[model samples]
Target chain A: MPFAPALHSEWLKIRTLPSLAAGPAAVVLVTAAFTALAGLDESAGADSDPLFASLFGVVLGQIAAVTFGAQAVSAEFRGGALRLSLSAVPHRGRWFAAKALAVGASALAAGLLAGCASLAVGWAVPGSRAGGPNWGEGLRGVVGCGVYMALMALFAAGLTALLRSGVMTLSILVPFLLVVSFVIGGVSGTAADYLPDKAGQVVLHSTSDGALGPWTGLAVTAVWAAAALAAGAWSVRRRDA
Target chain B: MTSIDVRDLTKEYGGRRAVDRLTFSVRPGRVTGFLGPNGAGKSTTMRLVLGLDRPTSGTATIGGRPCAALDEPLREVGALLDTGAAHGSRTARDHLRVLAATHRIPGRRVDEVLEEAGLAAVSRNRVRTYSLGMRQRLGIAAALLGDPRVVLLDEPSNGLDPEGIVWIRELLRRLAREGRTVLVSSHLMNETASFADHLVVLGRGRLLADTPVREFVHARAEPRVRVRTPDGAALRDLLARHGYESVAEEGEGAGDRWTVRHARVDDIGRLASGAGVTVLELAAEERTLEQAYLDLTAAEAEFTAMSPSRAQEA
Candidate 1:
């Protein structure tokens, strides 16, 4: 079959499941709400990057993005779902690619919506708008957020496929994003900035002192996602359903 | 109509051979029973045919094409490996829709199958809320969604009530009547006997017997004659003289009753009549498919526990 039908099948699976369907909405709500709250906070330093603060909600929202990706693949492990899937579409590589594409598209759409909501909230809040980012920076942050969320979701998806368990993927990724990324960022080095989560988030910042620019940072994260996806596809092709 | 051809297919898991060099062909327009005892590699073989697992050796193909090579395989082959393959949170309709989408099968066909499986009223319910039988129906519905020419079902009658079993039996027959190749696996020979016209018996990952269902029973089970006669002793003596041994029946009417094995009813009647013995009742007892399957797989069962008394002795 052509890739479109496989992709359509994958899209149906995502939209039909309650937990999977809730992912995008959760991403938009959590990211927007947190970004609005952060915009309203009065304890900011004078030289704080307004764009990062406006899009700060992405840190929390990324959990939903990762979860969306993880569950898309992990659901297949439950009750021999993968067996059914493979029987329908026997080409494992094509199926995996379609699955990844569905996940990426959903997460990216949610990320863009979340980014716009966060920016709108920042403009609405008088305290945040006092030093808000210009339209060029805001536009970059919105587009960057979409690409960043898509890459993170793909990363989680690939990891889930490799691990063959959504819980295991979440256990590793959730902690890494919530704790390890920040802890490593605290250590002064350019290498820490290249970490998948940190590198992707650099695009949300209005100003940066790091060696990598916004697009390059996103590219670094994209490499991580690509590597994870490659590993996932290999696992799918090599392993029995 | 497509035929399933398996040639010396083998599959090994963790150094243990789940399916040995097994070969069988299922032709169109017939319901072939894939029979075996538990762990006799029936499921493994089906998985190999569907390309869910890589074979250690040999090949299985539908219409001369490997399952992986067929584009939109659902349109060519429909398989029901596990009833619970669908996500519990999704409704039966949605589960079928997901599979149907793969081959671009129309949404109307999904509803048609749901109705055909007698699950239309409950199609909107989440699979988690369904009974085992309902899930089974949903699985069958998904299998029929593409209206494929080849249907492979593993233990399809499991979790079904009597009426449901009968319903599935009729459905399999109808599928076969439509010139589709149907392979339904089961450990229960009696259940298989009710529907399958052909039998592919498996024992210890090896092909045991592949023939017509009736022929399998007739070939494996010893034919016996149940005779009740007033002069049973005289008849028994006459049969013994002809090198036929007869055992006395031990039930309520123990008087003048004999069961003769490996002897035709006509021969028994002729022997009795030649000796002027009066025969009260004489008939050939048909061996049930259950007995034939048990006799065939008696030594081939994967796990056979010793009797309680034998265990104590051991």
Candidate 2:
């Protein structure tokens, strides 16, 4: 089947459900809400990156990105949904591609919106702030934040498809992002630099210490997303609906 | 018209076979009833045909081509396998709209099917609010959305009311009249008997019978003759002398009725007359489709229950 109609169908599925729609909406709201709140904090370390302070809420916003991704795929595993979807398309690969595309698009939009809004809130705050990054660096952080969210969402979508369970995906992902990745990040080890969540969040920081720069960090996260998607596609093609 | 051909189709999960080299063909212009006791692999066969599950060793194809190869598959074969397939959060229209988009179907057809399935009034309502009967109707609507040449329904009457059942019975007959291939699966033999012109029955993942509905029912029914005579004792003696077994039926008229199995009505009548006994009634008891289905699948039944009559008596 041509991509146009399949894409349209996938888009409709995304727009139709309130819970699914909440995924992207939450990404923007959470990021902006947290970033705005952080700007009001009176204490600021002299060496802290100003852009990082503005976008501090992105860490939590990504929870929405991953949730949206997992839910998009997980909904198919419920209510005999896989049967209905496959019956309509028959070719599992094609159907999954459409689903992945839809998830990626939504996450990208949500990320961009969240990234921009968080920056605006941070830039406008009146509290004691560190020296703000120059224009080029500031612009990169906002756009990179959006792209990061999209990639993270796709990453979640891919893993959910492989597992075929949203609960399972969230169970492994949510706590790991909130606890394990940060703990490893605090250690400032090279291994933490390459983690999917941390690597993607590098764009939110104006200056970084590791060999991996903002763009390079996002690239590592993208590689992870690509691998998950490849596995997810294989699973959809080989398994019975 | 679309015809489905299953060539030695087999499906096994882990080690046990769910469908064992099952071969059957569903031709166009007729309603084929897929009959089986629950877990006799009726749904499995349908799933295999739809390419929902990969066959272990064989192939099932629609219109002489594999289902996966068909372009816009819904246009060739429309299927309703699981009644509760829709997502609860979406409205009924959204579900149909998504399926319709797969085939590049027009929005007009979506509205048409909403009316067709009697879901027009609640088109905007979320699927979670719909009753099981309504959900079944929505499934039926989704199947018909493509206006395909072949239609497959698995237990379409599952949650339907009496009116919905009658409506579906009429609908399937009409679809067949239009020269489309229609296959409907049901555990209820009597339900399928009402409209299915052809019957393909499975027992323990094997083809038990693929024949006309009328013959499968009455022919399989034990072929017993109910004899009633004023001199029942004399009739019993004659039956014993002829080496034919008789079971005395107890009821309102005890000792006046005896059922003779494996004997034609004419032979029983001849024996009664030769003995100079006046026969009051010599009616041959015809078997219903329900009974035929039970007798055919009794051995294969994984969990047997009391017969309908026995249950009623209890």
Best by DockQ: 1
Q: What is the DockQ of each candidate?
A: 0.84, 0.73
Model 2, A1-241: lDDT tens digits are 7877887888888989899988899999999998887778776566667788888889899999999999999999987888888888887888899999999999999988897888888888876285666678778988899889989898989999899899999999999999999887875547888999888777878778876889999999999999999999998888888
Q: Which docking category, incorrect, acceptable, medium or high, applies to candidate 2?
A: medium
What are the lDDT figures for the candidates, one per model?
0.90, 0.87
* Candidate 2 chain B: 10-residue stretch with minimal lDDT: B302-311
Poorly placed runs, candidate 2 (over 4 Å): A44-46, A128-131, B239-244, B251-255, B264-276, B299-314
lDDT of 2 at A141: 85
Once all C-alphas are superposed, what RMSD does model 2 give against the true structure?
Answer: 4.6
Q: Candidate 1 chain B: worst 10 consecutive residues by lDDT?
A: B305-314
lDDT of 2 by residue, B49-147 (tens): 888888998999999998888888888888888877899999999999998988789989999999988899999999999999999999999999999
lDDT of 1 by residue, A35-111 (tens): 87877778876677879888989999999899989998899998999999999889999999999999999999999
Clashing pairs in 1: none
Candidate 2 displacement at residue B278 in angstroms: 3.4
